[model samples]
Target: MIYDLLIVGGGVNGCAIARDAAGRGLRVLLVEQTDLAAATSSASTKLIHGGLRYLEQYEFRLVHEALAERELLLAAAPHIIRPLQFILPHEPSVRPAWLVRLGLYLYDHLARRKRIPGSRAVTLAGSAFGAPLAGAYRLGFSYYDCRVDDTRLVVLEAIDARERGAELRIGAKLVGARRDGDVWRASISGADGRIESVGARALVNASGPWVQETLTQRLDLRSTKHVRLVKGSHIVTRRLYAGDHAYLLQRPDKRIVFAIPFETDFTLIGTTDVPFSGAPGPVAIDAEETDYLLDSIRHFFRVEIGRGDVVWSYSGLRPLFDDGALKASVVTRDYAFDLARAEGAPALSVFGGKITTARRLAEHALETLAPFFPRLGPAWTAQATLPGGDLGPGGFDAFLAEVTRAKPFLPPSLARRLAGAYGTRLWRFLEQARSMDDLGEDHGCGLTEAELAFLRAEEWARSAEDVLWRRSKLGLRLDGAQQARLGRCF
Candidate 1:
């Protein structure tokens, strides 16, 4: 079948575009070389934020659009997207308190924020939100942003795309493409190493870190601009703070690091920006980056954390648009598209996008392709709910209550976690599980064989890493032996 649109990458931007296009009555096909979001999407800071630092660069338009989309996404997928509060400690060495307040003031008023609370000042000594910080810091600011299950967001988009009549192919890499008159003929190699050909009226390359590689090497397309590869890494450790709020610590070098409350019992601290020339996939946090993160954490927190405290660490390469920026930390997180059309064929390549801006990027991408798909349906994804996101605007607590009533035998923590991850779709998993025995053996932290099967059947989970690292946070709870057992089971 000749698809109306063919999307390459299967990351957030690609999956989002596929969902939007398919929902708009276009026949779409999306191909991924690896598991969905196995790249930059899953390796994000995992926040649906407005890029608070972008305000310094006068990126008000990007920040406003992202902030508006934050509320829309929260309403659309309350299961995976929810509001999170962050504490920013005041440092005399950094920006003045007045300047910080002014920037946050602009940030709060920039977006059409309906559900999230605005920023407020707090005394670090007496406020509950500042108990985790060092005693030297006595003043701080608290603000709101949304947290997301970045990987599941991508999977849900792919699921929504499939539900909307789009063909979704995983582990299928785009090997070659050529313009054939009014259409583009693309060749994709599946996981089994078998190549398949497909024709499309238009093509989109949303390959995050591999954008330039896909265009230059795979598709033989050339561009004057290139992407600068910047690596950001995160470390997970046992929870150090007492409260539910996260922290945004400012380093003396003018960089900010996030110390977020993670997974009930742990804290997620990260992300140092450094130039990288290594491969995109299999990116690992090196000793230098680990030490840098630890130093940053130690600088602000009363609790000291060394390498011994780290239980897990991960790294991802950001495909930033190279504009000769010398400092990796200053590189812009905004995105741009290169639309190429040679008479009858068209291909649009995307570069430098974040999880927060994916939906808007899709809308703009479709707008770019409107000339080719002249008769395609109008844009409609802004208000559409992703798969498993049809929670009827009910608050999370209300949704949890409904799940608890349906599965009385389920432990409160497990039920809440499942409901948070799967939303109303938890019903499907609980339909056959009447008792705790029906949940299968506990693999620690509520992970069970039944849950694994559900993920495999519904969430396109093919490997243990896909389940542990992406689909859920079971990786932090499970040890090496347990991971190996899960791998064998898969």
Candidate 2:
């Protein structure tokens, strides 16, 4: 059967496009070379902000569009996405105070922010928020963005797309493709060495960093547009501060690094934008990047951390559009589409995009493909709730209270974690469990056989890495032995 669309890549954009296209009465098929969000999507700084840094580059339109999506996404996925106050400490040596204020002002008024609070100046001296910072950083600005579970967001999108009659082929790599008359016949290889061929009227290249390779290597197609691979790495350390608020620190070089609260027991710092020349797969954070991140924290906060304090680190490649920028930092974070329809079937390739604007990107992608599939329905995802996102009128806090209240026998921390991760669907798996034993053997860090079964059956989790890292961030909490046990179980 020829599908209306066959999307290559199962990252956020691909899954998002599948969800959008399927909801519009289109038969969609999405194939991922690896697990869903195993690449750039899972390795983000994990924020749904308006790209406050883009304001410096005069990217008003990008920031405005992202801020609008931020509000919509927060409402749509209240369980994973929530408000995060960013403390931008004044660093006169880096950027002038007036310039910072101007950017924040634009960030506030550039879009109609309904739920998120607007930006404001604050005195950091002797305040709770200032305790972690040095004495020199007395003045600061507080603006709101959002923090999200990046992996779960992708999984949820794929789930929604599949429920809408889209086929999600995870662990399936597109081996080759050729345009055949009016339809494109593509070859795919599954993880177990099974080969399959599918046909589609149109194709979308949403392969994140592998966009160019998908066209030139896999499909034997070429385009004028190219992607610049920028590597962004982050390091996780023990909790650096006590507050929920995150800090946006400016360096002497003018690049900003974030120090955010992570996993309730650790601090997440990262993201160095360096030009990467190596292959994208199996990317790891180098020692130099780790030092650079630690130095950024040492420059701003009073706390002194080093490699000894580092617990976990990850790096992702951004398939940014090559606009002839001299530095990787200045490369545009915006996305562009390259539509090539020559002789036979049409194929659309996505260039650059961030997690904050992925939904809008999908919408724009559909609009680009509207000519090919004219019967597509009107856009409806803007007001839709993702899987398990509905928690009634009270939202997350009320939902958490209800979960813990209903399952009083369960540990409060485990219940809260389950509720936060699964939202209204937490009870679906927990309903049968009366006590800790019913949840099955603990693999440490609150991971249990019951939760593992749910992830494997519902979320398409195949490997232990898929469960420990992507499904939830239990990797940071689980030890070597626990991880080994988890690997053996699944």
Report how far residue 311 has shifted in candidate 1, in Å: 0.5
Residues 36-69, candidate 2, lDDT per residue (tens digit)?
9999999999899899999888888999999999
Cα-based lDDT for every prediction: 0.88, 0.91
Residue 200 shift from truth in candidate 2, angstroms: 0.6
Q: Cα miss at 480, model 2 (Å)?
A: 0.8
> Tens-digit lDDT track for model 1 on 1-490?
6888889988899999999898888999999888999988888888999989989888889899899999999988999998999999998788999999999999999987899999999888866776667656788999999989999899898888888899988888899988889898999899899988999988898988888888888778998778899989999999988888899988888889999988889989989898988766668899999999899888888797899999989888889988677898888888888988866789999988889989989999999888777687898988888777887756788889988988898889899899889987777777788898898987777887788888988888999999999999888888889888889877
Off by over 4 Å in 1: none
Q: List the residue pairs that clash in candidate 2.
A: none
